[model samples]
Target chain A: MVSSPATARSFARQEGGAGLRDSVWGARELLVALVARNLRMRYQRSALGFLWVLLNPVLTTLIMVGVFRYVLHIPVDQYWGFLISGYFAWIFIVHSVTESAGTIREHSYMARTLAFPADVLVISTLMSRILEFVLEIILVASLLAVFRHGGVPAAFALLPLAVALLVGMALALAYPIAAASVFFKDVEFALPVGFTLLGYLSPVFYPLALVPEAWRDLYSLNPMVGLLGIFHAILYDGRVPPFSLFAISAVEVTILLVIGRQLFRWKRSLFAEIV
Target chain B: MSSDVPRIECVGVTKRFYHYEHRTTTLQEFVFRQLAGKPLHVRTPTFHLEGFDLTVRTGESVALVGANGSGKSTALRLIAGIYPPTTGSIVTRGRLVAVIELGTTFQPELTGIENVELYAAALGMRRREVQASLSSILDFAGVDEFAEVPLKYYSSGMRSRLAFSIALGSDPEILLLDEVLAVGDVSFRAKCYDRLAAYAANGGTMVVVSHDMDSLPMLCTRAVWLEGGRSRLDGSVDAVVQAYLQSVTSSS
Candidate 1:
């Protein structure tokens, strides 16, 4: 129906304000479809196809675990399990952020012609990483059963909570990078290095306890460290993370997400020009 | 005219873009001094739109005819809410779908059907709504057979046809056409004109941005002639098109 002229004029900003909210709710289907298409297209042309999904972490874990466990004499039972849980979670974060930072550049075609929230592109990037993580979880579960000679742990009940935490964290982290990368092309170039440094500093492969006592307290301030701790608690320790770590993870994720979302929303209108 | 409301109101709506003087070579230059804190700089940035004004009522199709750099697309971007005006105010009601730069919007890796869902949804159609519209859209584009194929594989003609079909099918209250019809095949072009004609007959507001004189009268009732970021003429399509054509012919 034709919206009256006056409404159209004022609606530019009002509808824009509402449109920003509606874009989140309205674009859900497009988001799912984009992610699914990428998943299928990525593997369809590969010779090894879906096998790479299982082999990637397995091979990485084998190399790391063997080196640290045999050569470095790190305790395999606690430490290997610790490394596995934290590293995979870290991989998901790094992969999602790095891939999503260039989402607008990669999908310039859609951005130029269509009017939609750019967040959907960022979501698609996160979605693919989530798919990979789900596969990693399945592989890790099977390995745990095979190696430990035990069925899945009871902490598996916390899977939903872990996923919720991951999604919130991804949203908080990815949008600002994704949104800004449009104008700042260097963001894409800079993310990989930043992620690698983050992996080393965030206790992805090493235990947080290895840090000097003085620094350990400050390093826990890295939000990913807390998130990784949560993952280790549920998967390796077979329990919920401490309330302190959980609270830190939640607060940091919430703050980053709110800030990232505001920045993204503020920048969204200008994207068509700069991009 | 309704005493209370104009369907669209641009009270001195203006837009100015910052153009960089030189492409910075290194990350240091690109980031720290050059890129970080400036939207406008005196070294090279030029402000284009001093004050652009226009208003449209419901069911009014206003063609914004201009030369290449006359800011037609910029105006449409402002109206679509894709880009906020750098200055002044713009108010618009209803859903606005801009069919500018067709085929430039689909994700290269996505299949035709997938791109259709994404593009249509971007226009604010719900998933169920797009699914309902999908068959008709594909049929209209005549690319139904290639529905599952990746968009990167589609020919330019096929892509434009599909893009146009989606844009037209969305039933936008205000449709912005930015020379999208100029690229498709002859028959496809004819079909687009026919569809646009029908859409206009149904009282859908439209704004066409084009340099094509022949096509203007066929699609528009009123036209605005733009030159060097200024409106040179605004009147019936025939008068403006004739005036533009005479000026161009004389200049050549």
Candidate 2:
């Protein structure tokens, strides 16, 4: 029932703009099925199942808190709250981008054989990661509540905006990266190194105050800095992020999305041939 | 809704594939090529199909008969919207379901029933439609007993059977089949033919690519014989299949 009665339609190429939106809207069922399959496959064989979603961030945060708090002796108070908030946001971006970059190649056979929108693969990968990240955010909020007698911050109401911005940024990057990775094997090899460098460059582990004032403008150009700053401001500092941070992040996401969508649309039809 | 209206049309359709030789697959290689004043990627274009045209009306069954690499499958894929034609236009009316390489979209780790839902969705079927047809699909594939088992455990025959059943259950207005009848055992294939015949008789538009000369006439009323991507002959199934068979024997 999704499609109406026969109407003359051309299938020469995938459409763009509103036509592309309609195609995606028509394909929403496929998107849901793909996301469901992705979630199931992620933990199907693991004995711990969904626990792995929580365990990954918890375990990684514990190690970082141990190192920064005890061994490295960083001066930030309530380092667990600071680290957990920023780390969860950072990991979400990292996992979504890294996994999405290779999703088209992983499902190349399906892309070639099936006629569904190829971008659905990238979107579904991000959706599954987003679902996992939502669960991880709950865990972070609980830990923050326990550590601080103030309970969860009221500013946390703005957390959805932060998550939305993070996802928008991730998708903007993922579309182009996923499309390019199909042709260039280098993307697969280069992503981890790029993320590693980005991790050090962003304010994921340490406080932004430690960053020298002069270098902050250049650092903020990374996009993740603004996004992580938003998370940190709301979750750890219990306040709204500066309007400038939201503005910068929004502008960057818009530009990246436009470029990413154009590049992805141009390259997708070629995928069935190449991949 | 008119029976005379064309369900599928191809106008001067041409498909070309580039054979990449020493393609630049890395940034370093691209940079080196730029420094050396060489093209970023080198490839030779080969035409798979050229200036091909066909039209299938509603309730019509057509057979694309050709040897391997003659563009029958490529044409089917182009019509199915899998690949954009390199230099032409393809228009289709009605919901289309293509069984090109069955089970290729199925995940290995997912159970049989799960894959059915996934595959149905891939074919553009909604969740409710898939759920409604789920039992019949499983029963037709004869994999109902193992519906909960992962597809990785299914035999090759079982996988194709399940895939074919799902495609048929989708109630497609236009169905494209590329040598799908070659799968499964004898009885199952007979069942597949029966299902396809029933579909064709029920006013479903079908363009099938098959080499089984005997069965092509049984299912299709007309045949288009392709040679090197161009239609060499187009006529009633009996005449075209006979001529094609004669060419094959005489050439051999």
Candidate 3:
């Protein structure tokens, strides 16, 4: 049986210039189907099901607000609102990196069998997290609107812009760690520890202002700071942040993404072997 | 091109695989490994292909016969562009699909239908196009009743049938089969071979690597015998098969 010329053409076009065009493009449909399967399997046996998407973030945000605002007496209104916004964003990065580190290793069977680009696994894993992140964004935005204190701001229009920046940052952080975990098994152990340190050091728990003034500049080098700062500004402050902050964030995000992709490619061949 | 150029070609290709220790019991050994400038016990990498050369023309069904670890699979992988050669190069001009580990490509958690779509998509079919052919593909795989079930639940025969169906369903210009005939029941294998015959009749090129010398005369126009990653004989399937079988029987 001959595949239609139209199907072949469309496949070639999607591949564009990559050497893996045929394999990668061919796997595209399968990628979507597989992802849908993963999504379904994830929700299938659980009693709570999809509700957990909303419930998990809401529960975590409540805990953070209760501890920081109620116990610490931070005196902030709509504190759950603020905590929810930042926590959801932080979770996106944490969850993506935590799970994706061993993506190739976990899928060793599929990797050896199918001829699709190995990067498709990375892309698929990222996509599942992204879908979940979108759900979190919607839930957090709805909660903020319903609560009505520190209500939705005009600057919220920039939320998409902030989300784009964070996604780039997350992908940047994930690539090298994912690649290294294939050969350097120690990276798997170190990843959780690194995420824990990054959790406290970044603005996930406390506002950046809490840090001593002299050390704040040094800390901003943590790209999460730039990402979280921008997200918090949009939700809590209701204003577009200063241009300098956005500019610095844009530069840092670009560098990390480029380097990450390079490292991932560099170690690509070893995946089938080591994994 | 006057059929001068080989449809499949490999020039002096070499591949090596390093073996790593299963587990190091102590941190001292781990540290000492790097400091010692060597492994405590290093297993030399096995060479799958070494300085191998071969050529097959258009419209030819080439059966590659070799014993276990004889570089048959490695050569096929190289031809399919799955792994680059450590030395030399592999050059080809058409789409190639290797039916190596069949349904293993399907994620176990996903349903059979989902796997068909995913595998088809990876081969470069668009979502809608794949959807249009979805029912037909399932019908051909003959597992329509179990289409909705997850792949992990499928029997080995069912998996083999489905994988072969999907691989052939795509209609690639070049097909590489790695001992897939050994899978499934006898009737299913017969059906697969019949389908493959039709595929070859349609001018599709095929390269099959198998230990079944009896089947070579029926399937292949010409065959190549590989030993230690080198071609030991090349001729009509019957002659090459006879030579290989004779060599093995006399040696034993």
Each candidate's DockQ score against the native complex? 0.34, 0.47, 0.27
- Reference-based TM-score, model 3: 0.89
The estimated TM-scores of all candidates read 0.89, 0.94, 0.89
True contacts kept of 1: 0.35
lDDT by residue for model 1 (A1-275), tens: 21122223333452422252246566676677777767767776476877887787779988998888778886447566777777877888887777887888788766765666888888887887787788787666566555653677777677667767877887788898888788776777788888878778887777777788999878877888788888877777767677887777788889999999999987786676667
Clash list (residue pairs), candidate 2? none
Model 1 per-residue lDDT tens digits across residues B138-227: 999999999989888999889989989998888777788887768678888898889988988887778888878888889989998877
How well is each residue in B1-252 modelled by candidate 3, as lDDT tens digits?
245656677766677765755544343456788797866554556678777887767678999997888889988877766665666656665666788776776777778887887777666556776788788778777899999998889988888888888888876767889888786888877877888888888877899999888877777888999999888888999889998889889999
Q: Which ten residues in a row have the lowest lDDT in candidate 1 chain A?
A: A1-10
Off by over 4 Å in 2: A1-22
Model 3 regions more than 4 Å off: A1-31, A44-47, A74-77, A146-151, B1-5, B20-43
The parts of candidate 1 lying over 4 Å away from their true place are A1-11, A14-22, A44-47, A76-78, A149-151, B1-5, B23-27, B30-42
User: Considering just chain B, what TM-score does every model have?
Assistant: 0.89, 0.96, 0.88
